[model samples]
Target chain A: MQDQLKLQRAALADFGLFAFRCDDVDELLHRATELVSEALDVPLVKVLEHWPDRGEMLIRAGVNWQPGVVGHETFGDDVRSPGGYALRCDEPVVSPDLDVENRFEMPEVLRRHGVRSMVNVVIAGEGPAYGVLEVDAQQPRGFTEDDVAFLRSYANLLAAAIERVRVHEELRRSAREQGILARELGHRVRNLLSLVRALASRTSAQGRTAEEFRTAFIDRLQALSTAESLVFESNRERTDPLVLAEEVLAPHRQEDAGSISIEGSSVDLSARQARMFGLALHELATNAAKYGALSVAGGKVSLGWDLEAQKGARKRLSMTWQESDGPEITPPQLKGFGTRLLEDVVARELNGEAKLAYRAQGLNYTLSFTVDG
Target chain B: MIDNKDGNLSGRRVLVVEDEHLIAMDVQDILEGWGCTVMGPVASAAAALELIEGDLPDAAVLDVNLNGGTSEPVAEALRNGKCPFLVMTAYNASHLFGALAGAPLLNKPVDETKLRQELSALLADTASDRCSGT
Candidate 1:
């Protein structure tokens, strides 16, 4: 009786530690299997659960079992079978001598695996029996009634822990999927808004009475929108100027099929600079279409750009817009809204300077700006 | 100067370069009511150019976008031939012709009265120029 009380206290203490511990499921299961094997001093200990569809007893965890024996072995749903009989009773069943117990009918497979005595505890719950936890030894009459009671209690704790860990793993997976979906949705929303803004700007510009300003402003807005979409879509901190320019100009290819002319070495621009340049190009294209070469049949617009190291130890980007074969143009008497928009609004907003020239043959516009490294 | 009250637009030939079929028909009806000959509600830039090459209209009302691209070529041809042309665009004038900054532009949905007044003025100028032989 004294030994029984000492064993009960030790089992309760181990149960308390298992209940409060918050380790991962695999680690927790491994520790539980080790503790049960040690506490019971059984040669083999295993936790098995019912496979409802297959109607069999399948091992979830095992200690001191031969390689591949735990996962591969199973007891089917025959009521006459030993495992099925234990599940039906919903109580611990000790077989002191399996060879003499005729009603027990232990399978030949179990005997081949060298099992002599066995204690099986049904994991009964609010619903149907879950399965059984079993301890096996080579010597007959090895398991007592006390061993059956101790194993049943241990099985209850393991079942609760498994359910808790399953819920935790599922929650983690759900949270990770939600985070990815949210980021993708945000990016798509931003792109759609940018597109709407570009459409609005173009519509407003095309309503201008002064044809020159109308063309210049519309083209510039289109270019800016294109570049803005590219940068936002890339999700990158920096972009190359040449690649950005190409994307902006792609939609405005000449009717004659002449490729857009590029004239500069590659320069890397910060995200802000790339957007600013996009807006500037839009303005240039609009102007070219209204009075420059783009306004005439078979006319060509040439884009030239170069980078200069300024005296202030800053790199300045210079771009020139030239048009040929367009209508004979005369200088405007007043600075129009487009001029103000590009030279004042855009330049001030982007920290750049612009020059506008209304030549007799076409229009020439230049923009110079510093870009951050 | 031609008086606004004058109903007749006899001997006047008008070119209509609009992409939308419904809008083109509306403009055609307006010109015909004024007793002018209406040439086309041309759908594409190529078609407009073809019509212009065949017969020069006394005046034209052009939409800035036709089919997929700009109607700048039609505008250019009219300017080269010294024919008076007005642009009709859904886009604002300041946005439509940035480089050739000072051309006459009309916004859509167009104000019929303004369009009539501008067309009358342009026709009157052309008639006077012909009389003066300049």
Candidate 2:
């Protein structure tokens, strides 16, 4: 008996240390079962959790079970089961003999396993209840009151460990989510910088002056910023292409006048597509403000799009920007940054075809892409 | 027939694996201006890997993160196949662990001139011995 008490103290001390060593709830629960078994010298000790909603007890954690992992279930919780009896009250239920014990039903889960005697203690009872702790024996045995008291203390420690793990799991989940969010923010910033660098490079290649490149690049960046903000505000992957065009042209439009006329219906574009398309609009609007229809009084620009019929029953969304009522258009000797962005980058990125015409009357830019919707 | 500043990158195929569209376009222009043939500015690492499986390029410029996925598999393939490649990333070197730690890394907002200079030297050295067989 002296040895038994000493072993119990050793087991209790080990369990306290074990709680701090686990990274997973499964490992923590398994260690609890292992410690319980070692303390009492039982081969089969388990944590049977009450599932009132499920109308049965579940084997949450177990040791030396012949089948299954932590998810396995237990038999009905009728009065025949000592776990059920312990769950009904706050105290421990001690069954010394199953041969003549008629107080409760011996489930097949226990009887088939050759279990003769068992002690079931309520794990926690401050509120609803955590579950029942079952320590079983294969041979007939009478459990002393001291044994019951010691088992209760063990159950209390197990309950506290479960709560600790629950809080730990919550903290881990929050940290993981924060990590993902930070990564996403980092990705967005990187993409923004790359885009800016590319824009500056291409703009400088064709820009006649430093001022021209700076002005054009910043406008394009603003358009990109607008598209990103709209997407972020909606908290969705798809943004309205019409809204994208309007937002890009908003700053360029003549104050309180009919300088820009829009004619397109709403259509969905992926965030990537929206940003590319939005940049194209910024280029067109900026060019119009510089030398196209928006440069003169009563000058006007028509920005419109429609679903057009394609070969083999496919549909294409065609967007057009026509400028009129400005000075007679003179084709530039070299294609500028706006032309390259519209004709090359936008076309390539959206899988569309772009055409820029320096017509006698004004400039007309058109793009046709397969409707994503 | 190669110089440090102006190597004959003409007609040499170089694969560009980048997810950002405009950056890829800039790379294409710079590579094309140097007279090199561009293989791809592929949007994802998986697609880039698929493209190189059938026919390897003379050299490769791989972005470390392809649409939020690591381009390590492509890097591993290039290494295993005795191919030379450059790694570009927005992430820091400390965050890069394991088999991927020690390779060359160029940060985002890449300096195009430096990239060209490095590539020219890399190609000039290997182009003499490497392209002769392929």
Q: Which candidate tops TM-score?
A: 2
Candidate 2 lDDT by residue in tens digits, A39-87:
7888888898888786678888889877873468675665656777788
Segments of candidate 1 deviating more than 4 angstroms = A19-26, A124-129, A142-145, A205-373, B1-134
Q: Mind giving the per-residue lDDT tens digits that candidate 1 earns over A1-373?
A: 5675466558657765875575475566556667766676666777666787897877666787777766777877556667777887777778877877665677765677677788888765436666677777777865656666677777777667666666777898899999877865554344334333333433444445677546554565566566666666676656777788777766656455463476765766765567667766665666666656766677777777888886665677888877766777776666654565567545654567887787765677788787643
* TM-score of chain A as modeled in candidate 2: 0.83
Candidate 1, residue B70: Cα displacement in angstroms equals 32
Q: Model 2 chain B, poorest ten-residue lDDT window?
A: B125-134
Docking class for model 2 is medium
Chain B structural similarity (TM-score) per candidate: 0.84, 0.84
How far residue A323's Cα lies from its native spot in candidate 2, in Å, is 2.8
In model 1, how large is the Cα lDDT of residue A208? 51
RMSD of 2: 5.1
